[model samples]
Target: MTMAWGRSAAVGVGAGAAGVVAMTLVEKLEQRITGRPDSYVPARTLERLLGLAHARGRRAWLHNLAMHASQGAMLGALRGVMAGAGLRGPWASLMFFAVRLTNDQTFENASGVGAPPWTWPRDELVVDLAHKAVYAFATGVVADALAVRWGPGPGQVHAEEFPGRRRHIGPPPRA
Candidate 1:
Protein backbone atom coordinates (compact mmCIF):
# COMPACT_ATOMS: atom_id res chain seq x y z
CA MET A 1 0.00 0.00 0.00
CA THR A 2 1.09 3.53 -0.72
CA MET A 3 1.51 6.15 1.99
CA ALA A 4 -1.12 8.84 1.95
CA TRP A 5 -0.25 12.23 3.39
CA GLY A 6 -3.83 12.82 4.39
CA ARG A 7 -4.03 9.65 6.43
CA SER A 8 -0.61 10.38 7.78
CA ALA A 9 -1.70 13.85 8.87
CA ALA A 10 -4.73 12.45 10.63
CA VAL A 11 -2.61 9.89 12.40
CA GLY A 12 -0.03 12.49 13.31
CA VAL A 13 -2.48 15.03 14.68
CA GLY A 14 -4.30 12.26 16.48
CA ALA A 15 -1.08 10.84 17.89
CA GLY A 16 0.17 14.27 18.89
CA ALA A 17 -3.04 15.04 20.73
CA ALA A 18 -2.76 11.66 22.34
CA GLY A 19 0.81 12.44 23.22
CA VAL A 20 -0.27 15.63 24.97
CA VAL A 21 -2.89 13.73 26.90
CA ALA A 22 -0.37 11.06 27.76
CA MET A 23 2.10 13.65 28.90
CA THR A 24 -0.53 15.21 31.13
CA LEU A 25 -1.38 11.85 32.61
CA VAL A 26 2.28 11.12 33.18
CA GLU A 27 2.61 14.43 35.02
CA LYS A 28 -0.32 13.55 37.22
CA LEU A 29 1.13 10.13 37.87
CA GLU A 30 4.45 11.60 38.77
CA GLN A 31 2.75 14.04 41.08
CA ARG A 32 0.98 11.18 42.78
CA ILE A 33 4.23 9.30 43.12
CA THR A 34 6.35 12.18 44.34
CA GLY A 35 3.87 14.77 45.62
CA ARG A 36 4.84 17.57 43.26
CA PRO A 37 3.89 18.71 39.78
CA ASP A 38 6.07 17.06 37.15
CA SER A 39 8.20 19.56 35.31
CA TYR A 40 9.83 17.34 32.73
CA VAL A 41 9.70 18.86 29.26
CA PRO A 42 8.65 16.86 26.22
CA ALA A 43 10.61 19.18 23.98
CA ARG A 44 13.71 18.42 25.97
CA THR A 45 13.22 14.74 25.41
CA LEU A 46 12.76 15.30 21.72
CA GLU A 47 15.62 17.77 21.52
CA ARG A 48 17.95 15.52 23.45
CA LEU A 49 16.93 12.70 21.18
CA LEU A 50 17.64 14.96 18.24
CA GLY A 51 20.92 15.99 19.86
CA LEU A 52 19.86 19.60 20.18
CA ALA A 53 20.42 21.76 23.25
CA HIS A 54 17.61 24.25 23.01
CA ALA A 55 14.69 25.23 20.79
CA ARG A 56 13.45 28.56 22.11
CA GLY A 57 10.06 29.28 20.60
CA ARG A 58 6.97 28.29 18.62
CA ARG A 59 8.96 27.48 15.50
CA ALA A 60 10.86 24.82 17.34
CA TRP A 61 7.67 23.24 18.55
CA LEU A 62 6.26 23.17 15.02
CA HIS A 63 9.42 21.60 13.68
CA ASN A 64 9.39 19.00 16.40
CA LEU A 65 5.75 18.19 15.77
CA ALA A 66 6.37 17.62 12.09
CA MET A 67 9.40 15.51 12.87
CA HIS A 68 7.25 13.46 15.20
CA ALA A 69 4.62 12.87 12.55
CA SER A 70 7.18 11.68 10.06
CA GLN A 71 8.75 9.35 12.59
CA GLY A 72 5.32 8.06 13.51
CA ALA A 73 4.60 7.10 9.94
CA MET A 74 7.84 5.16 9.65
CA LEU A 75 7.14 3.32 12.88
CA GLY A 76 3.63 2.50 11.70
CA ALA A 77 4.98 1.16 8.44
CA LEU A 78 7.50 -1.01 10.25
CA ARG A 79 4.72 -2.40 12.41
CA GLY A 80 2.79 -3.21 9.27
CA VAL A 81 5.71 -5.10 7.83
CA MET A 82 6.14 -7.15 10.97
CA ALA A 83 2.46 -7.97 11.07
CA GLY A 84 2.53 -8.89 7.44
CA ALA A 85 5.33 -11.27 8.21
CA GLY A 86 3.07 -12.99 10.73
CA LEU A 87 4.18 -11.36 13.95
CA ARG A 88 1.43 -10.59 16.41
CA GLY A 89 0.34 -9.66 19.92
CA PRO A 90 2.55 -8.37 22.74
CA TRP A 91 5.82 -9.37 21.13
CA ALA A 92 5.06 -7.27 18.10
CA SER A 93 4.35 -4.33 20.36
CA LEU A 94 7.51 -4.94 22.34
CA MET A 95 9.64 -5.11 19.23
CA PHE A 96 8.26 -1.85 17.92
CA PHE A 97 8.81 -0.07 21.24
CA ALA A 98 12.32 -1.43 21.47
CA VAL A 99 13.14 -0.15 18.02
CA ARG A 100 11.98 3.36 18.84
CA LEU A 101 13.55 3.56 22.29
CA THR A 102 16.85 2.11 21.18
CA ASN A 103 17.02 4.33 18.14
CA ASP A 104 16.00 7.45 20.03
CA GLN A 105 18.29 6.84 22.97
CA THR A 106 21.16 5.84 20.74
CA PHE A 107 20.69 8.91 18.60
CA GLU A 108 20.61 11.11 21.68
CA ASN A 109 23.85 9.62 22.96
CA ALA A 110 25.55 9.70 19.61
CA SER A 111 24.53 13.29 19.02
CA GLY A 112 25.93 14.38 22.43
CA VAL A 113 22.71 15.51 24.02
CA GLY A 114 22.22 12.42 26.14
CA ALA A 115 23.15 12.53 29.78
CA PRO A 116 26.55 11.11 30.45
CA PRO A 117 26.33 7.60 31.81
CA TRP A 118 28.12 8.50 34.99
CA THR A 119 25.76 11.38 35.64
CA TRP A 120 22.60 9.31 35.75
CA PRO A 121 21.18 8.94 39.23
CA ARG A 122 18.99 6.11 40.40
CA ASP A 123 16.13 8.54 41.01
CA GLU A 124 16.30 9.68 37.44
CA LEU A 125 15.66 6.18 36.21
CA VAL A 126 12.09 6.41 37.44
CA VAL A 127 11.46 9.49 35.37
CA ASP A 128 13.14 8.05 32.32
CA LEU A 129 11.18 4.86 32.67
CA ALA A 130 7.93 6.79 32.83
CA HIS A 131 8.82 8.74 29.72
CA LYS A 132 9.75 5.58 27.86
CA ALA A 133 6.55 3.85 28.83
CA VAL A 134 4.30 6.57 27.49
CA TYR A 135 6.34 7.17 24.37
CA ALA A 136 6.42 3.43 23.78
CA PHE A 137 2.65 3.27 23.53
CA ALA A 138 2.38 6.39 21.47
CA THR A 139 5.03 5.10 19.11
CA GLY A 140 3.22 1.81 18.95
CA VAL A 141 0.14 3.59 17.71
CA VAL A 142 2.23 5.14 14.97
CA ALA A 143 3.78 1.83 14.11
CA ASP A 144 0.42 0.14 14.02
CA ALA A 145 -1.00 2.70 11.66
CA LEU A 146 1.88 2.41 9.28
CA ALA A 147 1.78 -1.35 9.49
CA VAL A 148 -1.87 -1.29 8.54
CA ARG A 149 -1.10 0.91 5.60
CA TRP A 150 2.07 -0.68 4.26
CA GLY A 151 2.62 -4.02 6.02
CA PRO A 152 0.64 -6.41 3.89
CA GLY A 153 1.85 -5.82 0.40
CA PRO A 154 4.66 -4.55 -1.86
CA GLY A 155 5.65 -1.26 -0.18
CA GLN A 156 7.75 -0.51 2.87
CA VAL A 157 7.11 2.17 5.52
CA HIS A 158 8.11 5.39 3.83
CA ALA A 159 8.15 8.09 6.48
CA GLU A 160 11.31 10.16 6.67
CA GLU A 161 13.54 9.52 9.68
CA PHE A 162 14.29 13.14 10.69
CA PRO A 163 12.47 15.71 8.65
CA GLY A 164 14.23 18.95 7.61
CA ARG A 165 17.26 18.53 9.81
CA ARG A 166 18.20 21.65 11.73
CA ARG A 167 21.71 22.92 12.01
CA HIS A 168 23.04 23.48 15.51
CA ILE A 169 21.71 26.57 17.26
CA GLY A 170 23.78 29.26 18.96
CA PRO A 171 24.23 28.82 22.68
CA PRO A 172 21.56 30.23 24.91
CA PRO A 173 22.07 33.56 26.63
CA ARG A 174 22.88 33.57 30.33
CA ALA A 175 19.87 33.86 32.63
Candidate 2:
Protein backbone atom coordinates (compact mmCIF):
# COMPACT_ATOMS: atom_id res chain seq x y z
CA MET A 1 0.00 0.00 0.00
CA THR A 2 3.04 2.21 0.23
CA MET A 3 3.35 4.89 -2.42
CA ALA A 4 6.14 4.48 -4.91
CA TRP A 5 7.36 8.05 -5.04
CA GLY A 6 10.13 7.66 -7.58
CA ARG A 7 8.20 5.56 -10.03
CA SER A 8 5.07 7.63 -9.61
CA ALA A 9 6.93 10.87 -10.29
CA ALA A 10 8.59 9.46 -13.39
CA VAL A 11 5.33 8.24 -14.78
CA GLY A 12 3.72 11.51 -13.93
CA VAL A 13 6.38 13.38 -15.89
CA GLY A 14 5.61 11.34 -18.96
CA ALA A 15 1.88 11.76 -18.39
CA GLY A 16 2.27 15.47 -18.02
CA ALA A 17 4.20 15.68 -21.28
CA ALA A 18 1.41 13.80 -23.01
CA GLY A 19 -1.04 16.23 -21.46
CA VAL A 20 0.91 19.18 -22.84
CA VAL A 21 0.77 17.67 -26.31
CA ALA A 22 -2.96 17.20 -26.05
CA MET A 23 -3.48 20.70 -24.69
CA THR A 24 -1.35 22.21 -27.44
CA LEU A 25 -3.43 20.51 -30.09
CA VAL A 26 -6.63 21.71 -28.50
CA GLU A 27 -5.28 25.25 -28.26
CA LYS A 28 -4.20 25.22 -31.88
CA LEU A 29 -7.62 24.12 -33.05
CA GLU A 30 -9.37 26.61 -30.84
CA GLN A 31 -7.10 29.41 -31.97
CA ARG A 32 -7.72 28.62 -35.59
CA ILE A 33 -11.44 28.85 -35.00
CA THR A 34 -11.41 31.91 -32.74
CA GLY A 35 -8.56 33.77 -34.45
CA ARG A 36 -6.96 34.30 -31.06
CA PRO A 37 -3.37 35.38 -30.92
CA ASP A 38 -0.85 33.32 -29.02
CA SER A 39 -0.35 34.42 -25.45
CA TYR A 40 3.30 34.90 -24.56
CA VAL A 41 2.76 35.05 -20.84
CA PRO A 42 4.52 31.76 -20.32
CA ALA A 43 7.59 32.90 -22.15
CA ARG A 44 7.58 36.22 -20.36
CA THR A 45 7.22 34.48 -17.04
CA LEU A 46 10.15 32.20 -17.82
CA GLU A 47 12.30 35.16 -18.83
CA ARG A 48 11.46 36.93 -15.62
CA LEU A 49 12.17 33.84 -13.55
CA LEU A 50 15.50 33.30 -15.18
CA GLY A 51 16.41 36.98 -15.25
CA LEU A 52 16.98 36.69 -18.97
CA ALA A 53 16.70 39.51 -21.44
CA HIS A 54 13.43 39.89 -23.27
CA ALA A 55 13.09 37.62 -26.25
CA ARG A 56 11.10 37.99 -29.42
CA GLY A 57 10.34 35.98 -32.53
CA ARG A 58 11.82 32.49 -32.44
CA ARG A 59 13.41 32.91 -29.02
CA ALA A 60 10.10 33.77 -27.42
CA TRP A 61 8.45 30.81 -29.10
CA LEU A 62 11.20 28.54 -27.80
CA HIS A 63 10.79 29.92 -24.33
CA ASN A 64 7.08 29.34 -24.48
CA LEU A 65 7.55 25.76 -25.56
CA ALA A 66 10.11 25.13 -22.86
CA MET A 67 7.87 26.54 -20.20
CA HIS A 68 4.88 24.54 -21.30
CA ALA A 69 6.76 21.26 -21.57
CA SER A 70 8.66 21.66 -18.31
CA GLN A 71 5.69 22.85 -16.37
CA GLY A 72 3.53 20.02 -17.61
CA ALA A 73 6.14 17.40 -16.78
CA MET A 74 6.73 18.85 -13.31
CA LEU A 75 3.08 19.24 -12.39
CA GLY A 76 2.26 15.83 -13.77
CA ALA A 77 4.36 14.46 -10.92
CA LEU A 78 1.65 15.53 -8.50
CA ARG A 79 -0.99 13.80 -10.58
CA GLY A 80 1.15 10.68 -10.67
CA VAL A 81 1.49 10.76 -6.90
CA MET A 82 -2.26 11.07 -6.64
CA ALA A 83 -2.71 8.01 -8.83
CA GLY A 84 -0.13 6.08 -6.88
CA ALA A 85 -2.08 6.95 -3.75
CA GLY A 86 -5.23 5.48 -5.33
CA LEU A 87 -6.78 8.81 -6.25
CA ARG A 88 -7.45 7.86 -9.86
CA GLY A 89 -10.29 8.55 -12.35
CA PRO A 90 -12.25 11.65 -13.29
CA TRP A 91 -12.63 12.91 -9.76
CA ALA A 92 -8.90 13.04 -9.32
CA SER A 93 -8.56 14.85 -12.64
CA LEU A 94 -11.15 17.38 -11.56
CA MET A 95 -9.15 18.05 -8.42
CA PHE A 96 -5.99 18.34 -10.47
CA PHE A 97 -7.61 20.90 -12.74
CA ALA A 98 -7.98 23.26 -9.81
CA VAL A 99 -4.43 22.64 -8.73
CA ARG A 100 -3.18 23.37 -12.23
CA LEU A 101 -5.07 26.64 -12.37
CA THR A 102 -3.85 27.73 -8.99
CA ASN A 103 -0.27 26.96 -9.89
CA ASP A 104 -0.47 29.00 -13.08
CA GLN A 105 -2.20 31.98 -11.51
CA THR A 106 0.15 32.01 -8.56
CA PHE A 107 3.27 32.04 -10.65
CA GLU A 108 1.96 34.32 -13.36
CA ASN A 109 0.69 36.94 -10.98
CA ALA A 110 3.61 36.73 -8.61
CA SER A 111 6.00 37.13 -11.49
CA GLY A 112 4.08 40.13 -12.83
CA VAL A 113 3.86 38.41 -16.17
CA GLY A 114 0.11 37.92 -16.13
CA ALA A 115 -3.04 39.19 -14.53
CA PRO A 116 -5.44 37.26 -12.31
CA PRO A 117 -7.97 35.01 -14.00
CA TRP A 118 -10.83 37.09 -12.62
CA THR A 119 -9.48 40.06 -14.53
CA TRP A 120 -9.45 38.19 -17.82
CA PRO A 121 -12.25 38.47 -20.38
CA ARG A 122 -14.88 35.76 -20.02
CA ASP A 123 -14.09 34.15 -23.35
CA GLU A 124 -10.39 34.09 -22.58
CA LEU A 125 -11.04 32.56 -19.21
CA VAL A 126 -13.22 29.90 -20.73
CA VAL A 127 -10.57 29.01 -23.26
CA ASP A 128 -7.92 28.83 -20.58
CA LEU A 129 -10.05 26.57 -18.40
CA ALA A 130 -10.92 24.32 -21.29
CA HIS A 131 -7.28 23.91 -22.20
CA LYS A 132 -6.23 23.16 -18.66
CA ALA A 133 -9.05 20.68 -18.29
CA VAL A 134 -7.77 18.84 -21.30
CA TYR A 135 -4.32 18.70 -19.76
CA ALA A 136 -5.59 17.45 -16.40
CA PHE A 137 -7.80 14.74 -17.76
CA ALA A 138 -5.23 13.54 -20.25
CA THR A 139 -2.54 13.46 -17.60
CA GLY A 140 -4.85 11.66 -15.20
CA VAL A 141 -5.65 9.02 -17.78
CA VAL A 142 -2.01 8.22 -18.27
CA ALA A 143 -1.18 8.27 -14.57
CA ASP A 144 -4.08 6.01 -13.71
CA ALA A 145 -3.14 3.52 -16.41
CA LEU A 146 0.50 3.44 -15.36
CA ALA A 147 -0.27 3.10 -11.67
CA VAL A 148 -2.64 0.19 -12.17
CA ARG A 149 0.26 -2.23 -11.92
CA TRP A 150 0.49 -1.36 -8.22
CA GLY A 151 -3.06 -2.48 -7.54
CA PRO A 152 -5.51 -0.49 -5.43
CA GLY A 153 -4.03 2.26 -3.35
CA PRO A 154 -4.37 2.59 0.41
CA GLY A 155 -7.23 5.05 0.02
CA GLN A 156 -9.12 2.52 -2.07
CA VAL A 157 -8.67 -0.12 0.58
CA HIS A 158 -9.83 2.31 3.24
CA ALA A 159 -12.89 3.23 1.24
CA GLU A 160 -13.83 -0.41 0.84
CA GLU A 161 -13.52 -0.89 4.58
CA PHE A 162 -15.66 2.11 5.51
CA PRO A 163 -18.14 2.10 2.64
CA GLY A 164 -20.53 5.08 2.87
CA ARG A 165 -19.93 5.91 6.51
CA ARG A 166 -18.95 9.54 7.01
CA ARG A 167 -18.78 10.11 10.76
CA HIS A 168 -16.18 8.82 13.20
CA ILE A 169 -14.03 7.56 10.38
CA GLY A 170 -10.60 6.52 11.55
CA PRO A 171 -7.30 5.76 9.93
CA PRO A 172 -7.24 2.77 7.65
CA PRO A 173 -6.24 -0.45 9.34
CA ARG A 174 -2.60 -1.52 9.04
CA ALA A 175 -1.72 -3.82 6.19
Q: How does each model score on lDDT?
A: 0.54, 0.93
Query: What's the C-alpha lDDT at position 23 in model 1?
Result: 47
**What's the TM-score of every candidate structure?**
0.49, 0.97
Cand. 1 Cα-lDDT: 0.54
Residue-by-residue lDDT tens digits, candidate 2, 1-175: 5778899999999999999999999999999999999999999999998999999999999999999899999999999999999999999999999999999988899889989999999999999999999999999999999998999887887898888969989987567
TM-score for candidate 2, residues paired by index: 0.97
After superposing candidate 2 on the true structure, give the runs of residues whose Cα lies further than 4 Å from its correct spot.
none
Clashes of each: 7, 0
Clashing pairs in 2: none
- Give residue 84's lDDT in candidate 2 (0 to 100): 90
List model 1 lDDT by residue over 15-102, tens digit each. 5345435645775688797886433244555676666667767856765565554454555555545544434346666776677657
